[model samples]
Target chain A: TQLLEQSPQFLSIQEGENLTVYCNSSSVFSSLQWYRQEPGEGPVLLVTVVTGGEVKKLKRLTFQFGDARKDSSLHITAAQPGDTGLYLCGGGGSNYKLTFGKGTLLTVNP
Target chain B: EPEVTQTPSHQVTQMGQEVILRCVPISNHLYFYWYRQILGQKVEFLVSFYNNEISEKSEIFDDQFSVERPDGSNFTLKIRSTKLEDSAMYFCASSPIPGYTFGSGTRLTVV
Candidate 1:
């Protein structure tokens, strides 16, 4: 089983639409990170949330860490075709490894 | 901006042959890692290295897998004997903290 669970395993939306993807875990973590990946490339770090109940915004992308540090959400405002990619959530797990989610495949139609 | 660099963006090898994947992490970073993603699967950790030694490894990192920081700036992962199932995209990463920078990845195809 995946330690981190992401919902809407696949999301397809039109341009100008908004969407929210979620990550949930039963275990707490010291930090949670979100990454966006395109085909044939490595994942690029989008944001990291260290403190509980903290909210961070990267332009149109908004990220939030739950008060317990066990969940996280990514909200995209006015999605664009460039926003299409794989969104993955990961937490600092044991052995210095990041426990990754199954990921949500988001495809924004232009 | 600094980035982790990986060579041979793609590799095709016969089963039972050995392959060594190379990486040059960002200068001044002390921690290094190897992660791989099988097609349609989430990225999985293979091993982490620090201070010239392995600090952690996953169950998937078995006898056939080994990691070494052969030089001050270069790190490598070797698969002793490749299997058909070993085909995947391997990524190299470096980190100063929880945040990490990853390489574009090397797609390994075992035939």
Candidate 2:
């Protein structure tokens, strides 16, 4: 089975600080997506990257897909209290199933 | 934006009792999935349904667990007999192909 390994299981930073979360895998995927989940809520899609070496931005957040389609990253700039949540990275493989990572719990204190 | 909806935000059931979780996926999406997350853990895939039939299921989805798309809009998951270990947040999701939209989830507590 393919597994997406996420690093920095937990992160805590003050407002305006920048942080980056990473997800790596050995198997290639057709698409990679980033999601943010708040307490008592489901994951909300942030961005979807299909092509290799692609970058997509949403406001102060940036998402990048690796050149091999086996990894992805999420970078947050000027983080705010609202940015505190669990960040998950999932990739759709050949079977079209999204294998989600363990997630990075980020806390941006004000 | 359109989103998936689930019923019973939270439920408490006795162990060995039957439980059913319901969901209404996005109107236009064709693929549906069920996922579970234990407290302080990552989400785990339970089952995927397409065309009113199951396409894939995880080992965690054992004989006691079943999925059904009784109507065009509603997808359901049933556990024949609940267990203490079954307590978790159950999420339902739908996607046309690539992007999946998940529901707020139902918190099941089996005691």
Candidate 3:
């Protein structure tokens, strides 16, 4: 079984702060995706990183895939209240099934 | 943007009762999936359906659980006998490409 382990399960920061969430796994993945979920809602796709050492940016959020494709990271720059939510990283392998990390709960207070 | 939608945002039932959860995925999507997340737990894949048949399933999807795409538009998950442990948030998702588009989800509470 493949598993993605996320670190810093809970983060509380003030507005304008920068934070990074990490997802690591022992198995390599073909692609990795980041998602943000608000209360009472399903996770919404934020970005997907397919190539090794790839980096993608969406507004204030930045996602990076490790060179080995076994890990990924999400960095939020100048986070605001709107950025507060549960962040999840999903790893896709050859089986076509997405294995998700436990997730990081981030709270950016104004 | 196209999205997946689910009905009966919440349902409460007694143990041993049967329940059916419905979902309508993006019209043009070819793959559909069902997932569940227990309170304070990570989301887990229950089953994946493609071409009107189950392509993959997890151990959690036992004899009590089944999935079907009755028509072109609707996908359903039926629980033959609900157990107290079945209480969780059930999410329906669809994929046109790789990443999935997930529905808001249905909260199932089995008493």
Candidate 4:
């Protein structure tokens, strides 16, 4: 079984602060995705990084896939209250299933 | 933007009763999946379906759990017998490629 471990399970910062969350795994992945979930709602896809060393930016959120495809990172620039939520990183391997990380709970206080 | 939809936003069932959770995936998507998240816990995969069959399933998806694409659009997850540990938020998701769209989810409570 492959496991994806995320660092700093919980984070709290001021509205204008920046933060980064990391997801790491020993097994290589075919693709990786980032999602943000709010209270009482399902996860919303934020971005998908398919290729090794690929980077995608969505407004203030930046996502990066590791060169080995075994890890990923999500960086939020000047986060806002709206960005507060649980951030999850999922990895897809040879199988059609997605292995999800424990997730990082972020709270952006205004 | 199309999204996945799940029915019975919340369900309360007896410990030994059966429960069926329904979902309508994004119209054009072909793959479907079920995941569960216990309160304050990580989301864990249950099963994945494609071409009317299960492509993959986790250990957590034991003998009591089953999935079916019965028709053209709806996907369902059936639990033959509920247990106290079954209380969690069940999410239905679909993906045509690697990016998935998940439904609002159904909170299942085994009383």
lDDT of 3 by residue, A2-94 (tens): 999998899999999999999999999999999999988999999989999999999998999999999999999999999999999999864
- Scored against the true structure, residue A84 in model 2 reaches a CA lDDT of 92
Candidate 3, residue A110: how far the Cα is off, in Å: 0.9
Shift of residue A105 alpha carbon in model 1, Å: 0.8
Q: What stretches of model 2 exceed 4 Å from their correct place?
A: none
Runs with alpha carbons beyond 4 Å of true place in candidate 4: none
Candidate 3: lDDT of A68? 96
Docking class of 3: medium
lDDT by residue (tens digit), candidate 3, B54-110? 989999999999988887899999999999999999999999777899999999999
Who is ahead in DockQ, 3 or 4?
4
Q: For model 4, what is the alpha-carbon lDDT of residue A30?
A: 92
How would the docking of model 1 be graded? high
lDDT for each residue of candidate 2 in B29-94, tens digit (9 for 90 to 100): 989999999998889888888888888888999999999988788999999999999999999999
Give the per-residue Cα lDDT of candidate 3 at A95: 40
Which stretches of candidate 1 lie above 4 Å from their native place?
none
Better of 1 and 3 by TM-score: 3
**Cα DockQ of the candidate 3 complex:** 0.73
Which residue pairs clash in candidate 4?
A: none
> Can you give the lDDT of residue A8 in candidate 3?
88
- Candidate 2, A1-110: lDDT as tens digits: 98999989999999999999999999999999899999999999888999999999999999999999999999999999999999999888644578899999999999
Q: What fraction of the correct interface contacts does each predicted structure contain?
A: 0.83, 0.74, 0.57, 0.88
